[model samples]
Target: MPTVTWSRLNEDRRAAVVAAAEAEFAAHGFSQGSLNVIARRAGVAKGSLFQYFADKRDLYAHITDVGSQRVRCYMEDQIRVLDPTRPFFAFLTDLLDVWVAYFAEHPRERSLHAAASFEVDTDTRVSVRAVIHRHYLEVLRPLVRDARGRGDLRPDADTDALLSLLLMILPHLALAPYVRGMDPVLGLDELSPDQPALVVRRYVAVLAAAFAPQPLTTATPGGAQSHG
Candidate 1:
């Protein structure tokens, strides 16, 4: 959390500090990010950063918290406008699209997110996961429950289990395109521009099958449809 001194800073100064810290942390993970560089970029003395945050870790945590909140709010806003009655798989794809769009519009946040995944300390990582899990339980639980009621999921499906599955893979769906080595077959360098979309469609199809009441006659792009 920022100290009272941070709130006293003018809006522009606050923005500059956050922007500089975001860029630094995005380029280098927390372990390697430099407060000196952040202060320099923000046009504040290095000593003054301590006035805003207790320490380097505090600054990093603050940046991550802000970035995560922005993503959650953006997702909620997009989900609010979506038609809840859309076909289950199509609806999931649209939600994923919202994530892709958010990252596209906020590349710095995206990079910071990636860096945080690799480098956050155990406590911070646990805290981040808890926040995400709460959001999933709040926003996604109702959707899956409704899907089951509509027969989109198997009669015996466990809503919490399905939600957990989605939660596990959701980060991959959002970040795979931006990260190297995310695809097993493609390894580090084979992620062509189109391959990312193809991978996403395949994931959607697999998820649809995992929870569907029956085998799908038609699957999303890059997925094989069942034929009898």
Candidate 2:
């Protein structure tokens, strides 16, 4: 939490501090992030940063909250518009498209997020895990239940496991090429407009085959007709 002094600062000053902190933390994660650099960037003396935030940890929490809130807003918009009636693959694929769009639009935040994943403090890591877990429980779990009610999933499918698998793989797939130099999921790190999406769809198709229930077949009084 920011101190009263931080709250009392004019909007421009507050923005400067946060923007500078965000850039520094994004570049080097918490351990390596430099408060001196942030102060320099924000045009404030080193002593002044303490008036706003108690320490680096406090400032980091604020920056992370800002980032998570923005991401949550994007997710809220997407989840509201998703149709449960669509096949799981179709729906998940669309959701991935939205995710890719989110990253693309907020490219400045990419290193911020990657730093959180690879080199953050224990507290930050725990909080991020909680946030992601909550997002899936609140937004994604319902989608799986809706699909089950509509018979899109197997009668005995473990909704928890299915959602977990998705939560694990989707983000990795999105970051594969960048995170792993020789990733099995290729083209994601390439700067092409379409390559990332193509990678998502291609892998999603393979995973969906395992998760999708049998295709529905319509039946007349005399016999069954496949629904193409």
Candidate 3:
């Protein structure tokens, strides 16, 4: 949360602080981000940052909130392109492609977001994770409803379950660079962006299989139900 002092700063000064902080957090993550460097980059005295933010934790929360707002804007743009008439797998694949591509097109933004997944302080993580999760569900509902109505998904499909799975996979879209840095031997980090896209395409197949309706059968009059 930004303090009243932070909100009262002139827009230029405000942007300077925000930009400097974003760069630091993007480059080094929260635990490693340097207040001293942030203040110097903003051309403010180190103590001035405390005036706008209670501490590093507050600053991280503000940054995470701003990131979520950016994600909201991106998803708003994406909602227009969603089409229930498209094949469900194709639509889903394209949608995820656009999501991963958004961050791909902006490396700094991607890094800032990926920062959230790292060693986070527990106090901030709970609230921050909840806010982003709420946004994910908000953006998912209408498109899912439309898909169901258009017969792209089964009527019994659990939107919650599906969304949970999708959101879990969505973070992995940004994990390539992080994974590469953490341990190159794991091999997932070595893939080109297109390779992950193909892997996720296979995941879409699994999701489609999971959501597809099962055939209903009845016991034959003469005998027993066959397990095979």
Per-candidate Cα lDDT values, in order, are 0.75, 0.73, 0.75
Q: Least accurate stretch of 10 residues (summed lDDT) in model 3?
A: 177-186
Sorted by TM-score (best first), the order is 3, 1, 2
Once superposed on the true structure, which residue ranges of model 3 sit more than 4 Å away at CA? 82-87, 181-187, 214-228
Clashing pairs in 2: none
lDDT of 3 by residue, 1-228 (tens): 789999999999988888898899888887788999999999999999999988777787787778778877876778566764576667888888777677777777778767777746776566456666767777777767777777777778987788889778777765663456643542456766467577667778889888755555567668866432
lDDT of 1: 0.75
- Candidates in order, TM-scores: namely 0.76, 0.74, 0.79
Query: Compared with the true structure, what per-residue lDDT tens digits does model 2 show for residues 1-228?
Result: 789999899999888988998899888886678989999999999999888878766777677777767777877788679765687778888888877777666765566667666665787666555555565577677788888888777787777878788777655643554554635536555546777778778868866666667676787776968674
**Top-TM-score structure, candidate number:** 3
Per-residue alpha-carbon lDDT of candidate 1 for residues 3-99, written as tens digits (9 for 90 to 100) = 9999899999999998898888889876688888999999999999999988766776677777777777878888777776677778888787777
- Would you list the clashing residue pairs of candidate 3? none
* After superposition, candidate 2 runs with Cα above 4 Å error: 3-5, 45-55, 81-85, 120-124, 127-129, 132-137, 177-182, 185-194, 215-228
Q: Evaluate model 3: give its TM-score.
A: 0.79
Instruction: Please list the residue runs of candidate 1 whose C-alpha ends up more than 4 Å from where it truly belongs after superposition.
Output: 127-138, 186-189, 215-228
